[model samples]
Target: MERMEHTSNADLRAAADTVLARLVGDVSGTARLREDQWRAIEALVADRRRALVVQRTGWGKSAVYFVATSLLRAQGSGPTVIVSPLLALMRNQVEAAARAGIHARTINSSNTEEWEDVQDEIAAGAVDVLLVSPERLNNPDFRDQVLPRLAAATGLLVVDEAHCISDWGHDFRPDYRRLRTMLADLPPGVPVLATTATANARVTADVAEQLGTGGSSDALVLRGPLDRDSLSLGVLRLSDAAHRMAWLAEHLDELPGSGIIYTLTVAAAEEVTAFLRQRGHTVASYTGKTENADRQQAEEDLLANKVKALVATSALGMGFDKPDLGFVVHLGSPSSPIAYYQQVGRAGRGVEHAEVLLLPGKEDEAIWEYFASLAFPSEELVRRTLDILAHAEKPLSLPALEPLVELRRSRLESMLKVLDVDGAVKRVKGGWIATGQPWTYDAERYAWVARQRKAEQRAMREYASTTDCRMEFLQRQLDDEAAKPCGRCDNCAGPRFTADMSEEALDAARVDLGRAGVDVEPRRMWPTGLPAIGVDLKGRLPAGEQAAPGRALGRLSDIGWGNRLRPMLAAQAPDGPVPDDVAKAVVGVLADWAKGPGGWAGGVQDPQPRPVGVVIVASRTRPQLIHSLGARIAEVGRLPLLGAVEYTGEVYPGPRSNSAQRLKALDGALTVPPALASALAEAQGPVLLVDDYTETGWTLAVAARMLRRSGAQGVLPLVLAVQG
Candidate 1:
């Protein structure tokens, strides 16, 4: 203990070496700190100054923080507080800390039961390092009651994945911006360390500026080249999603080692995982929707090399540490090159050669656009949100406030966090309350953010098409000062992977993709606060008034039949008769629907009757398609073609807004003609309600209600596609 105290103020290099030896155990006998790692440790421990370290994934950024924490604690400083963004990261850090003879603990969403014990450890000075997620910084109980004490006593502050602290970053989180308050309140001498593997010049500058204690000049920034020698980057332009899947099915075993297969959506992740399983590959699906216990199991499986891969979304990103991951493959391109770089960096961390492949698809841009729409809300919407809270009599939780605001639930939560950072609102025991503080909406800043996102999207497209070195392209995108062409990537050294799949594999993939039929579950409950929107409906719809579980030929976002259905249902497609092939596919779907697990053949005591008649929903844009489909279905089934439900009001033009607004627009838009009502009154069984596509399902719900009121036994929705 005496020797450790003496070494704290001695030569900083010697102290860092001592700590590094403890950090790496016997490995440190042959290992030495990189010059920049030593510099960051010195800045934090010796100089007691803030620093930001931007290096590639395997560059020992964690060593800088762990070494600094050891030095500070040896001198009797308080515990280090690490603000990490992911649970997987925190768990890995805790385990890593234990190897250095440091006692570490974490408080996060996953372990509320342990929080009290953790707090007791902190109070007892038994915890050497403490890690908490960024969201925990804004949690009402932690922020109001515990954060102040932790901030003042923190020996060192480390922000992992610090790119998230800047809005300029591709994956920014509003919760991270709340760190400004924590940074401001920290005791004067507590040093700060921020680290990330992915950040361009703009994001680095933004984060460095935020790290400023008294002035911007106080923060030292250390950035290095973003090249990963172990990763051989390549891009394969697939004809469509099915081709991408076929390529994977044909070549997955050829990849080097156990690794990750990334998909852009949870559904795609699950679909790909299922397909690979069918192909006899061991894989698991990981996504935001994955259960916590399952996520832990998946991570464990990947680390143990039990599964060949985990088909995952970005939820498996950042903070997952595996030293020898073999490869990374993307089913579709991400919207930003920086984000793609971060994900691929997860690979080749502790190996000689790991493959990185991107299979760009045509639907990638549309998916990008859909996500881009969820950026910070407009000033009008933000202002309206605050007004609602201000006028409320009590704190309002997210779901309780969701209907009052037109923004979606996720977007609304993000906006509330931003407002919390701006001091316009506060999250309390029950929910959020207006702080009654004046705030200004930064219109220029938001516009600049939007423009930045658009630029990133464009850069991603260039990345997919560029004829240059893929590694160099990614390095340059991150503004790496020493960016250079690697001699290993596909472009720099010619193609290392072939874009060929066996005809047998292609046939199997085609059959898989061609197999279609997605159950469209009826909207069971009405959106809450419908009365506020001037709709008489509220709560769950009665069983008699609801549409039965319906069927769509395919999901508009699916990788399968969606490719064929998209153009046909697109707004610009000219209305025409149902094509023969699509008609045949629909018939196949109906046949399977009658026998599938969730359908009438599921062995229910009471079976559903077959459709006795067909009713076409009025369509202004695709009248020819709807009428043709209804007529063809009736002809095929030998059923009566009931008169079409006529549009009694102005055309709805199909939901361009939220659910409430959509319902309002289509409230009285359709009515059953007297002939149709009379025919329905005479029908002995269910009738088929046909439309080109269903977006919100509110139209089907409303139409079904009318049919049921007209004495039809039941209404079954049959549509070409369902939009997600």
Candidate 2:
């Protein structure tokens, strides 16, 4: 690489002009690069130095990499490798690269079939930029077969949404840590760039240190003020979820242009989207659960202005580009101000002014706490996972390992990636293998990370209730030295929105939210490798023993009744009798459940007999709630109240383990009392099994099986709330 001092200023100026012209056509016009953008481009292309650019959204961060790639490719360098985080963002980057006459391609989860073709293009020197997801870096085949060649031949490397590489980042992804290995493998003088709009001083330092680009002081860090001049921020404290949904239905069209409405959960997004559509708004729902095809269509529709807005979760955040987005409304507050600022930055990129509002709900903090529980695993769990893999005779796939370990599938996958990066495990063609490398759990580091999360949560609460300027508060949270009141927020200016909702709208929202019942489909097959846990069950369960399809009053994660049931079912809440309203709601669900297609009245090939009696499942935690709910249902339906199923063993509660372990714990925990067996023997129809809450549904399945064997015609599992 040539030193910057040796290059003449005239040549550098001429090269920058050409790159700018490619970036924006008709360069003869006032289409020149900002000083910071030029500096970043010079560092990466001419000086051959690593750079970290922490500019706000729409500050031309992407332009620096695209232009640099164009210049580098002209000099016969290999294709630029960009690590992006979202599919929507990748699509937009591909299109933007095309406008500059650069050939770009992406290899992500959605396009595995195209990986071979992309590799061919790269080898043939026909590709200028190649985009990939962070998760792909840890994939066994890609890591072993493709990463080495790409790293050795890459011209420029870019990490978009680079904040995720830091543990202190609001959205940390373990897979991003794999970059450490890639960075080390790169040849000398290969320029690297990382860009994010949401990182504060701490996150910036952390990411820069991880980049390890000739040490932190040598790496060029260009961080600008974290403020969007076009966004007018505000917060409205809504009474509850219903009021929030009603407000959106009432005021969605009053905002500037088509934009995004972000929700904290997928269920809330779907509910809000449905309610808005009922009120005559053309919108779509976007979440992690959405299929790839549908997500693509939703993005295209939003970009084309075919819809008014997209009701989405954080799944739609980061890298989505739409210059003319008009507004951003949060149905619920995010856990961190950095995350909030990132989502709100999506608006007012091209336009002069846009609306950004946060409708804080009472349940927001609870939702935040629930997500906080999914952080990195404990030392014991990690050790257990490693021990399992080490003792196995052969490599263990994720499912096979799930039975031996207690972590859920998603969390387990994330932990494995972290271990793989730490050299404790290796992912091969068959499965994961223990490397037997000595590793120490970083207790102090994890504790610090936990404390940081709590502080971020506190900052978010402050952001919601602060009387200061919203933008200034958010900027200060990111450690922006230039933080100052924007003079446009609700605090600086007067209130921009009102909480007053008409009775008709409120009534409509209540009806929509109150109409609750979610089908709880029974588990039809036993988890694989059950015999390894000393359980006899395996393969498909017999049809005769399967529980009938069940119903729940609502999901614990829903936007409507969830708010009502969460507190009552909270781990800390005192156990008591079922509330009158909830009991009434259960009756409503039963009434609707009886009329559905597969209900007792439905004309099916095998019609189920109506439940003749009600049986309560004994609960150690919420015995009163379960017993009261069952007794009320029996009283209302005029049915016999059968004796309760006794929990004969120690109070195992419910599934805190994987399927195999949970089934093992619940195999013979329940027993039919003599009176209950006698009552079931004389029953003429199916019986309803009641419980307080259902999480894994293994408890319900076991109890239903016991009831069926005791001579009940069939068993119907009913619960107050179902875990999402």
RMSD per model, one decimal: 2.2, 2.2
How far residue 332's Cα lies from its native spot in candidate 1, in Å, is 1.1
Q: Per-candidate TM vs. native?
A: 0.95, 0.97
Supply the TM-score for candidate 2. 0.97
**Candidate 1: misplaced stretches above 4 Å?**
1-12, 25-28, 598-606, 645-647, 651-653, 656-661
lDDT of each: 0.87, 0.88
By TM-score, the best candidate is 2
Worst 10 residues of 1 by lDDT: 1-10
Predicted structure with the largest lDDT when compared to the true one: 2
Q: What is the C-alpha local distance difference test score of candidate 1? A: 0.87
- At residue 579, candidate 2 shows an lDDT of 93
